[model samples]
Target: MKKNYGYARVSSKEQNLDRQIEALTNYGINERDIITDKQSGKDFNRTGYVTLKNQLLRSGDTLVIKELDRLGRNMDMIKKEWQELQENRINIIVLDTPLLNTEGKSDLEKKLISNIVFELLSYMAEKERIKIKERQAEGIKKAKEKGKHLGRPKAKYPKLWEMYYFQWKSGQITAKECMEQLDLKRTTFYKLAKDYESKLIK
Candidate 1:
C-alpha cells in the first residue's frame, strides 16, 4: 500500500521544528512516519534523511516537507535527490508550495510541476549565494575599518627573522637572500617586514 511520510530539518538543535512538524501533522501524516534532522542543509548526509530515504521509503510512498528548503538549501543536491525519488517512484508533497505537491498527480502533471519547482529553487539558491557573498564582503570591510585582523592569525616569525629583516631593509642583503637565511616564504618574509614596521610605529 502507498504510504505518506514527512521529513523535517533545522540547521541547529536550538532551532525549533515545531512549525514544520505541525504542518506535517496537519497534512494528516502520522508522527511515527515523520523523520527529522537538526543539522545543516548544506549537504544531505543527515542521519534522519539518510535513514528515511534508505530504509523507510519505498516505491509509491510520498515524502512531505513543510518547505522546499526543509528538503535542502543546496540546489544541486536537491535536484539530484528529487530525481532519485522520482526514479524510485516515490512522490513528494511540499506543503508551502501547493502546486509542487505530487501526490495523486498524473505523470504529465508531475513533470510540469517538477520543472517549475526546479527552476524556482535554482533561482532562490543563486540569490542566496549572492546575498551571502555580499554580507561577507560587507563584514570584511567593516572589520578592516575597525582595524581588526581577519582570517587566520599570523604565524610567528622565524628565529632569524629580526636579523634578516634588518639586513634586508638596510640593503645589506637581498630580499631573496634574507628569506633563504630566515627559512621564510616570499610572502611571509614580506608580511613579517610589514609587521615589524607596524610594531616600530606603535
Candidate 2:
C-alpha cells in the first residue's frame, strides 16, 4: 500500500507550522505521515527533513509541500530535488498550486504550463529575497546618514551611572555592586564604564 506524506518547514522556531500542518491534515494526510522541519530552507541540512528523505520516502509514495520554495532556498537545489523525487516514482503535490503536481498530466500543453509556473514562482521568490536584503541595506545606510547607531540602543544611566562612578572611586562600592544597582548587564555596564574612564583620563 502506498502512503501519502506531507512535508512542512519554517525558517525559524518563531514561525508557526500549525497552518501548514492543518492544511495537510485537512487534505486527508495523517499526522503520523507528516514530517516537519523548524530550520532554515536556505540549506538541506535540516534534521527532520533529512530523516524523512533517508527513511520515509519510497517508490509510489506522494510527497506534499505547501510551496516549491519551502523545499530549499537555492533554485538549482530545488529543481534538482524535485527531479530526484520524480525519478524515485514519488509524485509531488504543492498544496497552494495543484497544477504543479506531476501525478497525472503528461501532455505537451500541461508540461509547458508547469514549466512556466515553476519558472515564474522560482524567479519571484528569488527576487523577493533579494528585495528584502536591499531594503535592509538601504535602511541601515539611512540610519547611519542620520547619525543613528547601527546596533543595540545605548544604555541611559543618568543618576545611577554617576552614583556608580562616585561610589567606585571612593572604594565604597565594588564595580560589581555598581553594575547590580544600575540593573544593566555586565557587558553593557563594563563597556560604558570603561569608555567613560578612558575619556576622563584623557
Candidate 3:
C-alpha cells in the first residue's frame, strides 16, 4: 500500500515548473500524487510542500523529487528533514542523484553508501552556498569602491529647496508649511535642509 508521491518546485514565478512536472509524470507518478510549489527552496514552509508532508504523505510512502535542492536550499535543514523522513520510514528518491535514492534497497551496504553520498553532497551544497555569498560580498565591495550606488538612489532635492530651507531656518515658515510648499515629507525636508547647510559650510 505504499504510494508514490512526486514533488516539484520552482524558486520564482518567472521560472517554469513544467520540466519538474514532466519528469515526475514521466516517472509514472499519478497526477494527483504530484505536488508543486512556486516558491524558494530556502525553506520548507511552502504551502504545497507542507501539505504533502503533513497531510498527504504517510509512513511507507515514497517521496520523489527532481533534485535534492528542490526539498530545500539549506544543507543543515535538508539533513534534518531527511533524517526525520528516514525515521518515519518514508522513502526518498532524488531523480538527479541515484546514489541518494532510498528506494528498493534494504541492504546494509546500500544504505551505508547512500548515507555517505548524502553527507558528501550536502556538505558540497553548503560550501557552494558559502562561496556564492562570499563572491557576492566581494562584488558589492568592489562596486562601492567604484562609486556605484548599492541600494535605492537618494531622492533628488526638490526645486525651490533653497528658498524653502532659508525660510524654515529663519522661522519665516513652519516646517509643515515648507514641506507643503515643496510637496515633500517632513523627513525629506529636514534631510534636504541638512545637506544644503553642509554644502554652504563647504
Candidate 4:
C-alpha cells in the first residue's frame, strides 16, 4: 500500500498548529500521518518535515500540504523540492486548491501551472522581505536623525564621566587608574568617557 503523508507549517511561534491539524484530520489524514512545523517557512531545514519526507516517502506515495506557501517562502526552493518528490514518484496534494494536485495532470501541464504559482509566490515573498528591510532602514535613519543611540544599553555611570574628565586633566592619572577609581570595567569606562568627550566637543 502507498503511504500517505501530510505536511503543515506556520511562520512563527505565536501561531497555533491546531487549526492545520484540524484541517488535516477533517480531510481524512490521520493525526499520526501529519507532520507539523511551528517555524518560519523560509527554508526546508525543518526537522519534522525532513523526518516525514525520509521515512514516509516511497514510489506511489502521496504527500499533502495545506498550501503551497506552507511548503516554503522561496519559490525556487519549493519548485526544486517538488521536483525531487515527483522524481521519487510521490504525488503532491495541495488541499487548499484541490486542482493543484501534481498526480491529476500531465507532466507538461503540471510544470506550467506549478511554475506560474511558484513565480507568484516567490514575488510575494521577496516583496514582503523588501518591505520589511525598507521599514527597518527608515526607522534606523529616523533614530539617527533624532540623536537616539542605535544599540546597547546606555552606561549607568554619570559620575564616571565627571571622574574621568578630572583624572584625564590631571596628567599623572592614567585611563586605567581613572577606570579603577570610577569602579567601572574598561568598556563601560571608555564608552561613557567617549560620550562625555563628544558632548564637550559640541
**Top-TM-score candidate index:** 1
Task: Name the runs in model 1 displaced over 4 angstroms.
Answer: 40-44, 140-202
Clashes of each: 0, 0, 0, 0
Question: How big is the positional error of residue 125 in model 3, measured in Å on the Cα after superposition?
Answer: 4.1
Of the candidates shown, which would achieve the greatest lDDT relative to the real structure? 1
Candidate 2 lDDT, 129-162, residue by residue in tens: 9999999999999998999998878766546678
Please report the TM-score between candidate 1 and the true structure: 0.69
Which segments of candidate 2 are over 4 A away from where they belong? 40-44, 107-114, 129-202
Summarize candidate 3's per-residue lDDT along 24-49 as a digit string, tens digits.
99989998889998885455468998
The sequence of per-residue lDDT tens digits that candidate 4 reaches over residues 1-202 is 9877888888788999888788888888888988988776445468887787787678888888878767665666677777788777788888887767876577787777677667766787799899999999999999999999999867776555675667677876888888777788888877887787798899
Q: Which ten residues in a row have the lowest lDDT in candidate 4?
A: 38-47
Flag the better candidate by TM-score, 1 or 4: 1
57-154, model 1: which lDDT tens digit per residue? Answer: 99999999998877665787688888889888899998988888888999999899889988987898899999999999999999999999999987
Error of 3 at 156 (Å): 19
Residue 6: error of model 4 in Å? 4.4
TM-score of each: 0.69, 0.59, 0.62, 0.64
lDDT of the candidates, in the order given: 0.88, 0.80, 0.83, 0.79
True-structure Cα RMSD, model 2: 8.5
Whole-model lDDT, candidate 2? 0.80
